[model samples]
Target: MKAFLPPTSYEYVTVHKVQGDDVREASDVLAAEEPLEIRVGYGPVGQREHRTISITMRTPGHDFELVAGFLLTEGIIRSRADLQGVLYCPDVQKEEERENVVRAELSPAAALDLPRLERHFYTSSSCGVCGKTSIEAVHAAGCPRLPPGGVRVPASVIHQLPERQRAAQELFEQTGGLHAAALFSPTGELRLLREDVGRHNALDKAIGAALFQDLLPLHEAVLLVSGRASFELVQKAAVAGIPVMAAVGAPSSLAVSAARNFGLTLCGFVRQQRFNIYCHEWRIS
Candidate 1:
Protein backbone atom coordinates (compact mmCIF):
# COMPACT_ATOMS: atom_id res chain seq x y z
CA MET A 1 0.00 0.00 0.00
CA LYS A 2 1.10 3.59 -0.62
CA ALA A 3 0.61 4.46 3.02
CA PHE A 4 3.03 1.81 4.23
CA LEU A 5 6.12 3.64 3.09
CA PRO A 6 9.66 3.52 4.35
CA PRO A 7 10.84 6.31 6.65
CA THR A 8 13.04 7.81 3.93
CA SER A 9 10.18 8.10 1.46
CA TYR A 10 8.49 11.47 1.29
CA GLU A 11 5.11 12.03 -0.37
CA TYR A 12 3.56 15.18 -1.79
CA VAL A 13 0.13 16.70 -1.51
CA THR A 14 -1.02 20.02 -2.87
CA VAL A 15 -1.83 22.27 0.09
CA HIS A 16 -2.49 25.54 -1.73
CA LYS A 17 -2.67 25.31 -5.48
CA VAL A 18 -3.28 28.32 -7.71
CA GLN A 19 -6.13 26.59 -9.48
CA GLY A 20 -7.32 23.57 -7.55
CA ASP A 21 -6.33 22.05 -4.18
CA ASP A 22 -3.45 22.76 -1.82
CA VAL A 23 -0.53 20.33 -1.53
CA ARG A 24 1.41 19.04 1.44
CA GLU A 25 4.47 16.87 1.54
CA ALA A 26 5.96 14.79 4.31
CA SER A 27 7.99 11.65 5.03
CA ASP A 28 8.68 9.12 7.78
CA VAL A 29 12.41 9.57 7.85
CA LEU A 30 13.78 8.87 11.34
CA ALA A 31 17.08 10.15 12.60
CA ALA A 32 19.67 7.44 12.22
CA GLU A 33 22.04 6.70 15.16
CA GLU A 34 24.43 4.02 16.29
CA PRO A 35 23.43 0.79 17.99
CA LEU A 36 25.70 -0.44 20.81
CA GLU A 37 26.43 -3.79 22.31
CA ILE A 38 27.29 -4.26 26.01
CA ARG A 39 29.60 -7.02 27.04
CA VAL A 40 30.48 -8.48 30.47
CA GLY A 41 34.07 -9.34 31.18
CA TYR A 42 36.12 -11.16 33.82
CA GLY A 43 39.83 -11.28 33.01
CA PRO A 44 43.13 -10.14 34.56
CA VAL A 45 43.28 -7.26 32.06
CA GLY A 46 39.59 -6.40 32.50
CA GLN A 47 37.35 -6.19 29.41
CA ARG A 48 40.12 -7.59 27.20
CA GLU A 49 37.88 -10.53 26.27
CA HIS A 50 34.25 -11.14 27.17
CA ARG A 51 30.85 -12.29 26.03
CA THR A 52 28.04 -10.00 24.95
CA ILE A 53 25.40 -9.76 27.62
CA SER A 54 23.00 -7.61 25.59
CA ILE A 55 22.76 -5.64 22.37
CA THR A 56 20.76 -2.46 21.90
CA MET A 57 20.70 0.20 19.21
CA ARG A 58 21.31 3.51 20.89
CA THR A 59 22.01 7.15 20.16
CA PRO A 60 25.75 7.81 19.73
CA GLY A 61 26.95 9.03 23.14
CA HIS A 62 27.21 8.05 26.79
CA ASP A 63 28.37 4.62 25.72
CA PHE A 64 30.09 3.82 29.02
CA GLU A 65 27.17 4.76 31.18
CA LEU A 66 24.89 2.81 28.89
CA VAL A 67 26.96 -0.29 29.55
CA ALA A 68 26.88 0.31 33.29
CA GLY A 69 23.15 0.92 33.38
CA PHE A 70 22.38 -1.97 31.04
CA LEU A 71 24.30 -4.40 33.20
CA LEU A 72 22.61 -3.02 36.29
CA THR A 73 19.07 -3.08 34.95
CA GLU A 74 19.70 -6.59 33.66
CA GLY A 75 20.69 -7.62 37.21
CA ILE A 76 24.20 -8.53 36.05
CA ILE A 77 25.99 -6.29 38.55
CA ARG A 78 24.14 -5.36 41.70
CA SER A 79 26.43 -2.55 42.80
CA ARG A 80 29.51 -0.80 41.43
CA ALA A 81 31.70 -3.27 43.34
CA ASP A 82 30.95 -6.02 40.86
CA LEU A 83 32.23 -3.91 37.97
CA GLN A 84 35.84 -2.92 37.49
CA GLY A 85 35.51 -0.28 34.78
CA VAL A 86 33.64 0.36 31.55
CA LEU A 87 35.69 0.54 28.35
CA TYR A 88 35.12 0.58 24.60
CA CYS A 89 35.56 -2.74 22.85
CA PRO A 90 39.14 -2.57 21.52
CA ASP A 91 38.03 -2.99 17.91
CA VAL A 92 34.90 -0.84 18.22
CA GLN A 93 36.61 2.42 19.16
CA LYS A 94 39.16 1.85 16.40
CA GLU A 95 36.45 1.48 13.75
CA GLU A 96 34.25 4.33 12.58
CA GLU A 97 31.08 2.28 12.15
CA ARG A 98 31.37 0.16 15.31
CA GLU A 99 32.19 2.79 17.90
CA ASN A 100 28.94 2.78 19.85
CA VAL A 101 29.44 -0.03 22.38
CA VAL A 102 31.25 -0.33 25.72
CA ARG A 103 32.39 -3.32 27.67
CA ALA A 104 31.63 -3.41 31.41
CA GLU A 105 34.59 -5.15 32.96
CA LEU A 106 33.62 -7.24 35.94
CA SER A 107 35.70 -8.52 38.85
CA PRO A 108 36.93 -12.06 38.29
CA ALA A 109 34.57 -13.27 40.97
CA ALA A 110 31.65 -11.44 39.36
CA ALA A 111 29.16 -13.25 37.14
CA LEU A 112 25.46 -13.57 36.36
CA ASP A 113 23.75 -16.15 38.52
CA LEU A 114 23.57 -18.86 35.87
CA PRO A 115 20.73 -21.06 37.06
CA ARG A 116 18.83 -17.94 38.02
CA LEU A 117 19.41 -15.94 34.80
CA GLU A 118 18.88 -18.71 32.26
CA ARG A 119 15.11 -18.96 32.51
CA HIS A 120 14.57 -17.22 29.21
CA PHE A 121 16.40 -15.01 26.76
CA TYR A 122 15.85 -11.61 28.34
CA THR A 123 13.29 -9.77 26.27
CA SER A 124 14.38 -6.63 24.37
CA SER A 125 13.75 -4.12 27.21
CA SER A 126 11.94 -5.61 30.17
CA CYS A 127 14.51 -4.45 32.68
CA GLY A 128 12.37 -5.16 35.73
CA VAL A 129 12.44 -8.51 37.44
CA CYS A 130 9.32 -9.70 35.59
CA GLY A 131 11.29 -11.59 32.89
CA LYS A 132 13.02 -14.01 35.23
CA THR A 133 13.04 -17.80 35.13
CA SER A 134 10.77 -17.66 38.15
CA ILE A 135 9.08 -14.85 40.00
CA GLU A 136 10.74 -16.32 43.05
CA ALA A 137 14.14 -15.38 41.64
CA VAL A 138 13.24 -11.71 41.84
CA HIS A 139 12.38 -12.03 45.50
CA ALA A 140 15.67 -13.82 45.97
CA ALA A 141 17.64 -11.03 44.35
CA GLY A 142 16.57 -8.70 47.15
CA CYS A 143 14.83 -6.36 44.73
CA PRO A 144 14.21 -4.44 47.94
CA ARG A 145 10.96 -3.12 49.21
CA LEU A 146 10.33 0.46 48.09
CA PRO A 147 9.36 2.94 50.75
CA PRO A 148 5.61 3.34 50.71
CA GLY A 149 5.82 7.09 51.30
CA GLY A 150 6.56 8.53 47.86
CA VAL A 151 7.29 11.91 46.36
CA ARG A 152 4.17 14.03 45.93
CA VAL A 153 3.69 16.50 43.08
CA PRO A 154 0.70 18.70 42.52
CA ALA A 155 -1.28 18.45 39.28
CA SER A 156 -0.16 22.00 38.54
CA VAL A 157 3.45 20.95 38.82
CA ILE A 158 2.81 17.90 36.67
CA HIS A 159 1.18 19.99 33.94
CA GLN A 160 4.32 22.02 33.29
CA LEU A 161 6.61 19.06 32.59
CA PRO A 162 5.58 18.47 28.98
CA GLU A 163 6.37 21.98 27.86
CA ARG A 164 9.55 22.10 29.92
CA GLN A 165 10.69 18.77 28.58
CA ARG A 166 10.07 19.97 25.02
CA ALA A 167 11.92 23.23 25.55
CA ALA A 168 15.13 21.38 26.48
CA GLN A 169 14.99 19.09 23.47
CA GLU A 170 17.81 20.36 21.26
CA LEU A 171 17.83 17.43 18.83
CA PHE A 172 14.12 16.62 18.69
CA GLU A 173 13.06 20.09 17.55
CA GLN A 174 15.10 19.62 14.40
CA THR A 175 14.05 16.03 13.79
CA GLY A 176 10.38 16.89 14.53
CA GLY A 177 10.06 13.54 16.30
CA LEU A 178 11.92 11.60 18.97
CA HIS A 179 11.39 10.49 22.55
CA ALA A 180 12.88 11.88 25.74
CA ALA A 181 12.99 10.90 29.38
CA ALA A 182 13.97 13.33 32.06
CA LEU A 183 14.46 13.13 35.80
CA PHE A 184 12.89 15.88 37.85
CA SER A 185 13.38 16.54 41.51
CA PRO A 186 10.38 16.49 43.82
CA THR A 187 10.25 20.30 43.76
CA GLY A 188 10.20 20.42 39.90
CA GLU A 189 13.84 21.04 39.09
CA LEU A 190 14.95 19.51 35.80
CA ARG A 191 17.74 17.21 36.88
CA LEU A 192 18.70 15.70 33.52
CA LEU A 193 17.26 14.86 30.14
CA ARG A 194 18.18 12.39 27.40
CA GLU A 195 16.69 12.09 23.89
CA ASP A 196 16.67 9.41 21.25
CA VAL A 197 14.69 8.41 18.18
CA GLY A 198 13.33 5.50 20.20
CA ARG A 199 11.44 6.05 23.44
CA HIS A 200 13.07 3.02 25.03
CA ASN A 201 16.52 4.12 23.97
CA ALA A 202 15.91 7.59 25.33
CA LEU A 203 14.92 6.12 28.66
CA ASP A 204 17.99 3.91 28.57
CA LYS A 205 20.19 6.93 28.02
CA ALA A 206 18.59 8.75 30.90
CA ILE A 207 19.00 5.75 33.15
CA GLY A 208 22.53 5.31 31.90
CA ALA A 209 23.30 8.90 32.86
CA ALA A 210 21.89 8.39 36.30
CA LEU A 211 23.83 5.18 36.76
CA PHE A 212 27.05 6.89 35.79
CA GLN A 213 26.40 9.48 38.47
CA ASP A 214 26.05 6.79 41.13
CA LEU A 215 22.33 7.33 41.46
CA LEU A 216 20.82 3.88 41.53
CA PRO A 217 17.59 2.90 43.24
CA LEU A 218 15.92 6.23 42.71
CA HIS A 219 13.38 5.68 45.46
CA GLU A 220 13.00 9.35 46.26
CA ALA A 221 12.76 10.49 42.62
CA VAL A 222 10.18 10.97 39.89
CA LEU A 223 10.62 10.04 36.23
CA LEU A 224 8.89 11.97 33.45
CA VAL A 225 8.56 10.68 29.94
CA SER A 226 7.96 12.68 26.74
CA GLY A 227 5.47 10.04 25.64
CA ARG A 228 3.10 7.41 26.96
CA ALA A 229 3.98 4.86 29.57
CA SER A 230 4.45 1.35 28.23
CA PHE A 231 4.99 -2.06 29.80
CA GLU A 232 8.68 -1.88 29.08
CA LEU A 233 8.89 1.56 30.68
CA VAL A 234 7.21 0.45 33.88
CA GLN A 235 9.63 -2.43 33.99
CA LYS A 236 12.48 0.02 33.62
CA ALA A 237 11.27 2.11 36.53
CA ALA A 238 10.85 -0.96 38.64
CA VAL A 239 14.43 -2.05 38.16
CA ALA A 240 15.70 1.39 38.99
CA GLY A 241 13.50 1.45 42.09
CA ILE A 242 12.01 4.75 41.02
CA PRO A 243 8.97 5.52 43.08
CA VAL A 244 6.89 7.35 40.53
CA MET A 245 6.50 7.70 36.75
CA ALA A 246 4.71 10.51 34.93
CA ALA A 247 4.06 10.62 31.20
CA VAL A 248 2.78 13.30 28.87
CA GLY A 249 0.68 10.58 27.28
CA ALA A 250 -1.29 7.51 28.34
CA PRO A 251 -0.24 4.31 30.02
CA SER A 252 -0.55 0.88 28.51
CA SER A 253 -2.74 -1.59 30.40
CA LEU A 254 0.28 -3.76 31.07
CA ALA A 255 2.26 -0.76 32.28
CA VAL A 256 -0.40 0.16 34.79
CA SER A 257 -0.50 -3.41 36.00
CA ALA A 258 3.23 -3.51 36.38
CA ALA A 259 3.24 -0.29 38.36
CA ARG A 260 0.66 -1.61 40.78
CA ASN A 261 2.40 -4.94 40.95
CA PHE A 262 5.70 -3.31 41.80
CA GLY A 263 4.29 -0.61 44.07
CA LEU A 264 5.40 2.16 41.74
CA THR A 265 3.13 5.16 41.29
CA LEU A 266 2.17 5.95 37.68
CA CYS A 267 0.67 9.09 36.17
CA GLY A 268 -0.25 9.76 32.53
CA PHE A 269 -1.84 12.10 29.97
CA VAL A 270 -0.11 15.06 31.55
CA ARG A 271 -0.41 18.26 29.52
CA GLN A 272 -1.15 21.93 29.98
CA GLN A 273 -3.41 21.75 33.04
CA ARG A 274 -4.31 18.12 33.59
CA PHE A 275 -3.00 14.60 34.04
CA ASN A 276 -4.29 11.10 34.79
CA ILE A 277 -3.36 8.99 37.79
CA TYR A 278 -3.07 5.59 36.19
CA CYS A 279 -2.22 3.64 39.31
CA HIS A 280 -1.90 5.49 42.60
CA GLU A 281 -3.88 8.62 43.21
CA TRP A 282 -2.32 9.21 46.59
CA ARG A 283 0.94 10.34 45.05
CA ILE A 284 -0.75 13.33 43.38
CA SER A 285 -2.28 16.24 45.26
Candidate 2:
Protein backbone atom coordinates (compact mmCIF):
# COMPACT_ATOMS: atom_id res chain seq x y z
CA MET A 1 0.00 0.00 0.00
CA LYS A 2 1.14 3.50 -0.77
CA ALA A 3 1.51 5.33 2.52
CA PHE A 4 0.06 8.76 3.10
CA LEU A 5 2.49 11.65 2.81
CA PRO A 6 2.75 14.11 5.69
CA PRO A 7 2.11 17.61 4.32
CA THR A 8 4.74 19.14 6.58
CA SER A 9 7.73 17.48 4.90
CA TYR A 10 7.61 19.63 1.80
CA GLU A 11 5.78 22.61 0.37
CA TYR A 12 5.44 24.69 -2.77
CA VAL A 13 7.07 28.10 -2.52
CA THR A 14 7.18 30.88 -5.07
CA VAL A 15 10.81 31.63 -5.97
CA HIS A 16 12.75 33.67 -8.49
CA LYS A 17 14.51 31.48 -11.02
CA VAL A 18 17.92 32.55 -12.26
CA GLN A 19 19.74 31.04 -15.24
CA GLY A 20 22.81 32.69 -16.71
CA ASP A 21 21.45 36.20 -17.23
CA ASP A 22 17.71 35.53 -17.28
CA VAL A 23 15.35 35.45 -14.33
CA ARG A 24 11.75 34.30 -14.01
CA GLU A 25 9.24 33.86 -11.23
CA ALA A 26 8.13 30.30 -10.61
CA SER A 27 6.85 27.99 -7.93
CA ASP A 28 9.51 25.73 -6.48
CA VAL A 29 9.35 22.72 -4.24
CA LEU A 30 11.03 23.28 -0.91
CA ALA A 31 11.83 21.04 2.00
CA ALA A 32 9.88 22.16 5.05
CA GLU A 33 11.34 23.08 8.44
CA GLU A 34 9.23 23.61 11.55
CA PRO A 35 9.63 23.64 15.30
CA LEU A 36 8.77 20.50 17.23
CA GLU A 37 8.39 20.57 20.98
CA ILE A 38 9.55 17.38 22.66
CA ARG A 39 8.24 16.62 26.10
CA VAL A 40 8.98 13.91 28.63
CA GLY A 41 6.22 12.36 30.67
CA TYR A 42 6.76 10.00 33.53
CA GLY A 43 5.50 8.76 36.96
CA PRO A 44 2.70 6.34 37.81
CA VAL A 45 -0.43 6.44 35.66
CA GLY A 46 -2.45 8.29 38.31
CA GLN A 47 0.27 10.91 38.85
CA ARG A 48 1.89 11.34 35.50
CA GLU A 49 3.56 14.60 34.59
CA HIS A 50 5.27 16.17 31.60
CA ARG A 51 8.15 18.52 31.05
CA THR A 52 9.14 20.22 27.82
CA ILE A 53 12.51 18.71 26.98
CA SER A 54 13.39 20.63 23.86
CA ILE A 55 12.12 22.70 20.99
CA THR A 56 14.01 22.14 17.75
CA MET A 57 13.53 23.37 14.22
CA ARG A 58 13.29 20.23 12.13
CA THR A 59 11.94 18.81 8.95
CA PRO A 60 8.67 17.18 9.98
CA GLY A 61 8.46 13.54 9.05
CA HIS A 62 9.38 10.64 11.26
CA ASP A 63 8.90 13.06 14.10
CA PHE A 64 8.36 10.34 16.61
CA GLU A 65 11.66 8.81 15.65
CA LEU A 66 13.26 12.22 15.79
CA VAL A 67 12.12 12.61 19.36
CA ALA A 68 13.22 9.13 20.29
CA GLY A 69 16.64 9.47 18.70
CA PHE A 70 17.14 12.90 20.18
CA LEU A 71 16.26 11.68 23.63
CA LEU A 72 18.48 8.64 23.34
CA THR A 73 21.49 10.51 22.03
CA GLU A 74 21.06 13.31 24.50
CA GLY A 75 21.29 10.81 27.38
CA ILE A 76 17.75 11.69 28.41
CA ILE A 77 16.47 8.15 27.80
CA ARG A 78 19.00 5.36 27.63
CA SER A 79 17.25 2.49 25.86
CA ARG A 80 14.05 1.34 24.23
CA ALA A 81 12.96 -0.13 27.56
CA ASP A 82 13.11 3.31 29.15
CA LEU A 83 10.40 4.51 26.76
CA GLN A 84 6.77 3.69 27.46
CA GLY A 85 5.24 5.20 24.34
CA VAL A 86 5.46 8.29 22.15
CA LEU A 87 2.53 10.30 20.85
CA TYR A 88 1.43 13.67 19.53
CA CYS A 89 -0.20 15.75 22.28
CA PRO A 90 -3.83 14.80 21.93
CA ASP A 91 -5.12 17.59 24.16
CA VAL A 92 -3.67 20.32 21.97
CA GLN A 93 -6.60 22.41 20.71
CA LYS A 94 -5.12 23.36 17.38
CA GLU A 95 -4.34 20.72 14.77
CA GLU A 96 -1.18 22.51 13.74
CA GLU A 97 -0.03 22.72 17.33
CA ARG A 98 -0.82 19.07 17.89
CA GLU A 99 1.47 18.03 15.10
CA ASN A 100 4.21 20.21 16.50
CA VAL A 101 4.19 18.67 19.96
CA VAL A 102 5.45 15.19 20.79
CA ARG A 103 5.40 13.56 24.19
CA ALA A 104 7.61 10.63 25.10
CA GLU A 105 6.27 8.84 28.10
CA LEU A 106 8.97 7.01 30.00
CA SER A 107 8.59 3.79 31.90
CA PRO A 108 7.11 4.14 35.35
CA ALA A 109 10.30 3.00 37.02
CA ALA A 110 12.47 5.49 35.15
CA ALA A 111 14.17 8.33 36.96
CA LEU A 112 15.04 11.54 35.14
CA ASP A 113 17.84 13.74 36.42
CA LEU A 114 17.02 17.27 35.42
CA PRO A 115 20.47 18.50 36.37
CA ARG A 116 22.09 16.11 33.91
CA LEU A 117 19.77 17.16 31.13
CA GLU A 118 20.21 20.88 31.75
CA ARG A 119 23.86 20.99 30.73
CA HIS A 120 23.59 20.68 26.94
CA PHE A 121 19.90 20.24 26.31
CA TYR A 122 19.29 23.04 23.86
CA THR A 123 20.50 23.01 20.25
CA SER A 124 19.50 24.63 16.99
CA SER A 125 19.22 23.05 13.53
CA SER A 126 22.26 24.82 12.14
CA CYS A 127 24.57 24.59 15.16
CA GLY A 128 25.21 22.30 18.09
CA VAL A 129 27.29 23.49 21.00
CA CYS A 130 30.88 22.29 20.89
CA GLY A 131 32.00 24.28 23.88
CA LYS A 132 34.43 22.78 26.35
CA THR A 133 31.58 22.31 28.77
CA SER A 134 29.51 20.53 26.15
CA ILE A 135 32.40 18.22 25.34
CA GLU A 136 32.71 17.41 29.01
CA ALA A 137 29.01 16.61 29.11
CA VAL A 138 29.41 14.21 26.21
CA HIS A 139 32.22 12.51 28.08
CA ALA A 140 29.95 12.29 31.10
CA ALA A 141 27.41 10.44 28.96
CA GLY A 142 29.79 7.44 29.09
CA CYS A 143 29.45 6.43 25.47
CA PRO A 144 31.97 3.61 25.29
CA ARG A 145 34.83 3.79 22.90
CA LEU A 146 33.90 1.82 19.78
CA PRO A 147 35.51 -1.59 20.04
CA PRO A 148 37.88 -2.89 17.40
CA GLY A 149 37.25 -5.71 14.88
CA GLY A 150 33.50 -5.21 14.82
CA VAL A 151 32.73 -4.52 11.12
CA ARG A 152 34.89 -4.16 8.05
CA VAL A 153 33.92 -2.91 4.59
CA PRO A 154 35.60 -3.29 1.25
CA ALA A 155 36.85 -0.13 -0.40
CA SER A 156 34.54 -0.87 -3.33
CA VAL A 157 31.55 -1.09 -1.03
CA ILE A 158 32.49 2.10 0.78
CA HIS A 159 32.94 3.92 -2.53
CA GLN A 160 29.48 2.95 -3.79
CA LEU A 161 27.46 4.08 -0.75
CA PRO A 162 27.13 7.75 -1.74
CA GLU A 163 25.59 6.89 -5.10
CA ARG A 164 23.22 4.45 -3.46
CA GLN A 165 22.21 7.02 -0.87
CA ARG A 166 21.62 9.61 -3.59
CA ALA A 167 19.46 7.15 -5.52
CA ALA A 168 17.24 6.52 -2.48
CA GLN A 169 16.65 10.21 -1.82
CA GLU A 170 13.20 10.64 -3.35
CA LEU A 171 12.57 14.01 -1.70
CA PHE A 172 15.89 15.44 -2.76
CA GLU A 173 15.21 14.45 -6.36
CA GLN A 174 12.16 16.68 -6.27
CA THR A 175 13.28 19.54 -4.00
CA GLY A 176 17.07 19.49 -4.35
CA GLY A 177 17.21 20.93 -0.86
CA LEU A 178 17.62 18.28 1.81
CA HIS A 179 20.45 16.55 3.64
CA ALA A 180 20.52 12.79 4.08
CA ALA A 181 21.94 10.10 6.33
CA ALA A 182 21.97 6.45 5.39
CA LEU A 183 22.75 3.17 7.16
CA PHE A 184 24.58 0.38 5.41
CA SER A 185 25.42 -3.08 6.63
CA PRO A 186 28.92 -4.51 6.69
CA THR A 187 28.27 -5.93 3.24
CA GLY A 188 27.27 -2.48 2.00
CA GLU A 189 23.52 -3.12 1.85
CA LEU A 190 21.65 0.14 2.24
CA ARG A 191 19.53 -0.54 5.28
CA LEU A 192 17.81 2.79 5.69
CA LEU A 193 17.89 6.41 4.54
CA ARG A 194 16.40 9.62 5.95
CA GLU A 195 16.28 13.22 4.72
CA ASP A 196 15.90 16.60 6.40
CA VAL A 197 17.05 20.18 5.94
CA GLY A 198 19.33 19.77 8.91
CA ARG A 199 21.95 17.05 8.69
CA HIS A 200 21.57 16.23 12.37
CA ASN A 201 17.82 15.75 12.04
CA ALA A 202 18.28 13.37 9.13
CA LEU A 203 20.79 11.42 11.22
CA ASP A 204 18.44 11.41 14.19
CA LYS A 205 15.59 10.07 12.09
CA ALA A 206 17.75 7.29 10.73
CA ILE A 207 19.07 6.34 14.17
CA GLY A 208 15.58 6.50 15.63
CA ALA A 209 14.29 4.10 12.99
CA ALA A 210 17.05 1.66 13.81
CA LEU A 211 16.30 1.97 17.51
CA PHE A 212 12.60 1.36 16.90
CA GLN A 213 13.55 -1.80 15.06
CA ASP A 214 15.77 -2.98 17.96
CA LEU A 215 18.89 -2.18 16.03
CA LEU A 216 20.83 -0.22 18.62
CA PRO A 217 24.53 -0.73 19.08
CA LEU A 218 24.85 -0.80 15.32
CA HIS A 219 28.48 -1.83 15.51
CA GLU A 220 28.22 -3.83 12.31
CA ALA A 221 27.01 -0.89 10.25
CA VAL A 222 28.33 2.20 8.52
CA LEU A 223 26.59 5.58 8.56
CA LEU A 224 26.89 7.77 5.46
CA VAL A 225 26.06 11.44 5.58
CA SER A 226 25.33 13.49 2.45
CA GLY A 227 27.08 16.56 3.85
CA ARG A 228 30.11 17.46 5.93
CA ALA A 229 30.57 15.62 9.19
CA SER A 230 30.48 17.75 12.32
CA PHE A 231 31.14 16.97 15.96
CA GLU A 232 27.44 16.58 16.65
CA LEU A 233 27.06 13.96 13.92
CA VAL A 234 30.03 11.99 15.19
CA GLN A 235 28.79 12.26 18.75
CA LYS A 236 25.32 11.04 17.82
CA ALA A 237 26.73 8.14 15.84
CA ALA A 238 28.89 7.20 18.81
CA VAL A 239 25.85 7.20 21.07
CA ALA A 240 24.12 4.77 18.69
CA GLY A 241 27.30 2.64 18.75
CA ILE A 242 27.78 3.09 15.06
CA PRO A 243 31.38 2.15 14.31
CA VAL A 244 31.83 3.78 10.94
CA MET A 245 30.75 7.15 9.51
CA ALA A 246 31.36 8.31 5.94
CA ALA A 247 30.61 11.66 4.37
CA VAL A 248 30.45 13.02 0.84
CA GLY A 249 31.92 16.23 2.23
CA ALA A 250 34.74 17.21 4.55
CA PRO A 251 35.08 16.45 8.23
CA SER A 252 35.59 19.28 10.65
CA SER A 253 38.63 19.11 12.91
CA LEU A 254 36.44 18.50 15.89
CA ALA A 255 34.56 15.79 14.06
CA VAL A 256 37.80 14.04 13.20
CA SER A 257 39.00 14.36 16.77
CA ALA A 258 35.76 13.02 18.19
CA ALA A 259 35.74 10.06 15.80
CA ARG A 260 39.35 9.30 16.65
CA ASN A 261 38.82 9.65 20.38
CA PHE A 262 35.78 7.40 20.24
CA GLY A 263 37.56 4.90 17.96
CA LEU A 264 35.06 5.23 15.12
CA THR A 265 36.04 4.89 11.48
CA LEU A 266 35.57 8.29 9.83
CA CYS A 267 35.65 8.85 6.08
CA GLY A 268 35.26 12.08 4.15
CA PHE A 269 35.19 13.43 0.60
CA VAL A 270 33.61 10.26 -0.61
CA ARG A 271 33.41 10.96 -4.36
CA GLN A 272 35.04 10.14 -7.70
CA GLN A 273 35.78 6.66 -6.38
CA ARG A 274 38.00 8.14 -3.70
CA PHE A 275 37.63 9.05 -0.07
CA ASN A 276 39.84 10.16 2.80
CA ILE A 277 39.83 8.14 5.97
CA TYR A 278 40.35 10.52 8.84
CA CYS A 279 40.51 7.85 11.53
CA HIS A 280 40.33 4.13 12.26
CA GLU A 281 41.58 2.97 8.89
CA TRP A 282 41.53 -0.65 10.00
CA ARG A 283 37.75 -0.75 9.50
CA ILE A 284 38.19 -0.37 5.74
CA SER A 285 39.94 -2.98 3.66
Consecutive 10-residue window with the lowest summed lDDT within model 1: 1-10
lDDT (10s digit) by residue, model 2, range 1-285:
112348878999899999999999999888888989899998887999889878888888999889999888887778999999999998886778868999999998888878756653533224466545455666677677888886889999989998889888988887999999999998888898888888988999889988999999898889999999998899899999999999999998888888888899999999999999999999899
Alpha-carbon local distance difference test for all models: 0.69, 0.86
Local error of candidate 2 at 95, Å? 4.1
Off by over 4 Å in 2: 1-4, 16-25, 93-95, 122-136
- Stretches of candidate 1 exceeding 4 Å from the true structure: 1-30, 43-49, 92-97, 114-142
Best by TM-score: 2
